[model samples]
Target chain A: AQSVTQPDIHITVSEGASLELRCNYSYGATPYLFWYVQSPGQGLQLLLKYFSGDTLVQGIKGFEAEFKRSQSSFNLRKPSVHWSDAAEYFCAVGAESGAGSYQLTFGKGTKLSVIP
Target chain B: EPEVTQTPSHQVTQMGQEVILRCVPISNHLYFYWYRQILGQKVEFLVSFYNNEISEKSEIFDDQFSVERPDGSNFTLKIRSTKLEDSAMYFCASSEGINSPLHFGNGTRLTVT
Candidate 1:
């Protein structure tokens, strides 16, 4: 079974400051990774994903993540965060095989608070 | 910019009552999924459907939960008996293809009292 862990339950950053959200996964092989953001009372929005390619993947809103096999980690980062970027972020991992063949295992989510 | 849409943004139901949550996925999408997130918790997958059959489901999706694609544009999740624990935000998502990224609906907040 593939599981995802996000150690940070909450993150606070000032506007224009760099931010990083840590994520680690336990899987037998290379897995699919995804980052999702959700504002209060809204559905989750996909931020980025890593299937198989360059270790560093770029995503919307100037966010990116690096897949580190050695660390079993895929952390989301932003050179600078905006006030509008405040939201709850989730790290998810999916296995290649499962009854829900493409089912995603999500972390507890890190609530990001951006201060201006 | 077609996206998934869910109906009944909020529904308050009595315990032991049946509730149906509806979703209209993107026109070109093929696979459908349902997930739930309790207050202050991680999102959990409930089930996945394709070709009018259940492809996968989680343990949380027991005999009480059922999904249907009654029409080309509608996908529905029905809970037989609403338990207090079932009160959560339910999200519906769809993907264009097997490996395509999924688009999600705003979700139906089911509140059982």
Candidate 2:
């Protein structure tokens, strides 16, 4: 079984400030990682996904994440936060099951609050 | 862009009543899935369907839950008897393959009263 953890329950940042949301996963083998964002009453929008490749991957809205194999972490980062960036962010890990279907295990999520 | 679509933005059903949630996956996708998130909780996978059969399901998905592709286009999840714990935001997703990223629907908020 695989699990994901987002240590921070809520994060607050001022406009123009840098932001970082941490994520950690427990898996037996190399796993797929994804970042998703959801606003109130909305569906999740994919920020980015990492299957296998360069350790650093870029995503929409100027967000990026670095995959650290040693730490088993895929932390999302943004150099400058904007008001519109405030939303609930989830980190999920995907792995192959006995059925050979890829299933995702999501973290509790970290809520971002951007201050004007 | 092509996206997964789910009908009934919100559903209010009484306990013990059967409720069916509908979804229309992307036209060419081969895999479909159902996930739910309780208020302030992580998204939990319910089941995955492919080729009109269940490929995988979680412990949370019991006999009381069922999924079907009634029409060639419509995928549905039917709960035999609703429970208060079933109240959550149900999301449908589809993907081209196992490695492909899933495209999710806006979600149907199920409120079991």
Least well predicted 10-residue stretch by lDDT in candidate 2 chain A:
A94-103
Q: For candidate 1, lDDT tens digit of each residue in A26-104?
A: 9988888999999988898999998898999999999999999999999999999999999999999976434334878
Task: Please tell me which predicted candidate would have the highest lDDT against the true structure.
Answer: 2
Task: Please list the residue runs of candidate 2 whose C-alpha ends up more than 4 Å from where it truly belongs after superposition.
Answer: A98-100
| TM-score for the A chain of candidate 1 | 0.95
CA displacement after TM-score superposition, residue A63 of candidate 1 (Å): 0.3
Model 2 lDDT at residue B35: 98
Per-residue lDDT tens digits for candidate 2, residues B1-113, read 99899999999999999999999999998889999999878899999998889999999999999999998899999998899999999999988876788889999999999
lDDT of 1 by residue, B67-110 (tens): 99999999999999899999999999998654567778999999
List clashing residue pairs in candidate 2: none
For model 1 the local lDDT of residue B78 reads 98
